[model samples]
Target: MILKSPFPAANRFVTIQATMNKTNPSKKQVVVIGGGVIGVCTAYFLSKKGAAVTLIEQSSIACAASGKAGGFLALDWCDGGALSSLARTSFNLHRSLAQELNGKEAYGYRPLNTLSLSVTESENPSRGRKQTLPDWIDGPVKSQRTIGTTETTAQVHPQLFTRKLVETAVAEYGVKVVIGKVKSVETGGGKVTAVVDGGGVIDGDAVVLALGPWSSKFTLLSSVINVHGVKAHSLVLEPRDKDAISAHALFLSYQQAHGGQPMDPEIYPRPTGEVYVCGMSSQEDIPDDPEQIEPNPDSIRVLKRVAGTVSSHLGEQSQVKAEQACFLPCTDDNVPVIGEIPGMKGCYVATGHSCWGILNGPATGAAMAELVMDGCSAIVDLTRFSPARFVKRRR
Candidate 1:
């Protein structure tokens, strides 16, 4: 298992070469920005490869969307393609890590069977909506049609999972973690030399921009790092009885109308004792910071209405415990960018996972470690996630 040191060791300092003047040659320094799930996991992988790594976070670790996400993880969510390969590999890794590093208990990892449901309102109410509902959705009174099933489908308490990963990265691997705001990347001849943060310049051999939604604005990092933010609202419902919901993670795409507004809501049940119900998916720029994004009232109402349809066993509207809004970082093509930035040596990007950041974090980290240490990954091909794809499109 990989881990990091709580304190920076004396040997952490590398000797600079005379000819290079300021560049360290004896030890490698890697600076990873953003302390979200992706950032922390990346730092963990790099540190395990013997690099003197420092992770910097703008706020408390995982305090943003990473802390509040519905931690649903699926092994076959991306079926029959490049993304499927990555997601499948990632799911396996998450399962192994959960068992090996005490991550399962720490993050509330549990296997679940997932079900997808949809309800249809008749185009003509007089025609009877029940008869109009698709045959695929209509089953004997007791069961719904099975779109798919995986006993390995799982979830983790994202907040605790992120914290534990960071702690493990620091306590066992000698990584230096700092709380600061990164102003910019200082580069010389298109190669990153240092990362400018609150304290001062942190000299490094490589700089990884894993800042989630915030990464979209730092275009100078690389023309390849084109990212956007998708704002979503989620509701946390408190079930009066803990066993009210089944052990399965149910994904419902039910039609809902709240205050005369119509919407489709998706629900994800977690092992952490919280049920996540969400709807609104909007492409909004969270300019200042992710934490500044607030849940829109309209979306909240829609989510509540949708939750009411599926959470009948959880309890009434008053049982709702919390409301949350978060931004998901995405690329134009709706796939994550995990490889190095085009034209910028020593610079890398790992954002753009959108809603799957938590699910893909470990796979991305392991791939990044292979790229940085062994020059390639054998577990999963990352060519599809390369930053160069975006650069070519711009041209």
Candidate 2:
């Protein structure tokens, strides 16, 4: 078949022909920077769409916030908002990806029942104390347990899931992985021509900036996209008896003895083993690279106090094995910045997923594939996620 450019007089046809015949005009390339969950998944779907994809990460793939996340997937968590629609679509895609990848071995996808409990632990005394406790929590609870059971609630080992997707993209779809710090995007005629990295310039017909928290840095260099980071803290715990915690996940509310404040701590029980996870101390405008984001002693104290409230339910002997902190890319309105980068031809941005990046990555990947390959998304409408929306709204 003779490949023809849309414009008959266009030189793209001659360029394509020359590349096919003898000269290697760099294969119609799509360079994706950042190998976190969003970047990896975007590259995977793009590769499946038959693009020559090169995913570049400065550090190891999945080494950033993607690996450090708590990995909870909840459909109703974003109920009755713009996020609700996207979350529903993404949840379905996550299930599909799990099935295709056999996530049991890597991501550990499993349904879970979630419960919210208010315990009488001294750490969270603001909830008011009562003599009788709920039979469920070993600690006497002043309030009744609010049981939330839904098949839609699920969890995955974030790093493993990202690794599996990247592996599948490379081994099954022929995507290439490159390790380098990208310097800038070379552009002319309002379109990206190549991406310059430490190794050298990597030419591409199209480029995608999926750099998560680092998206803002690239925008300063090339106006492709903008992103900021939201800091989060979490801790992994190994229950003294692992099996002492029940099959269901728990969210415990307690009062802080230090300031007499009330807070809720989430408990995530691993499906495969005795490890449990808790946390999330959050702060706005972290203003730091994800690599530099780490748990501080203050955040650790907050996590431990919250963990103590939940652990009291498991008989007060639970212990924390490790604590971690990382920044998740977030936008002004907290929705992902997806679709074309305004004013940048042949460039796309898919970052700022915030806390739900893992849960929503599959759907974002699929939507990205549609936008890049077919010029539109057939599933959830992406008009809300357009990178141009913010620019237009400001104007």
Clashing pairs in 1: 3-173, 4-169, 4-170, 4-171, 4-172, 4-173, 5-170, 5-174, 5-175
Q: What is the C-alpha lDDT of each candidate?
A: 0.70, 0.69
Candidate 1 wrongly placed segments (more than 4 Å):
1-26, 120-143, 148-152, 189-191, 197-199, 257-262, 315-318
Please write out the lDDT profile of model 1 over residues 311-368, one tens digit for every residue: 4444363378878888888788889988877767778889889878898998898888
> Clashes in model 2: which pairs?
123-255, 124-254, 124-255, 125-255, 133-140, 133-141
How far is 143's C-alpha from truth in model 2 (Å)?
3.7
Tens digits of per-residue lDDT for model 2 on 5-81? 11122221111111111122443467787889988988898888877777777666787788877677887778877
Q: Which residue window of length 10 is worst by lDDT in model 1?
A: 12-21
TM values, all candidates: 0.83, 0.83
In model 2, which runs have C-alpha deviations exceeding 4 angstroms?
1-28, 123-137, 140-147, 189-199, 220-226, 274-289, 312-319
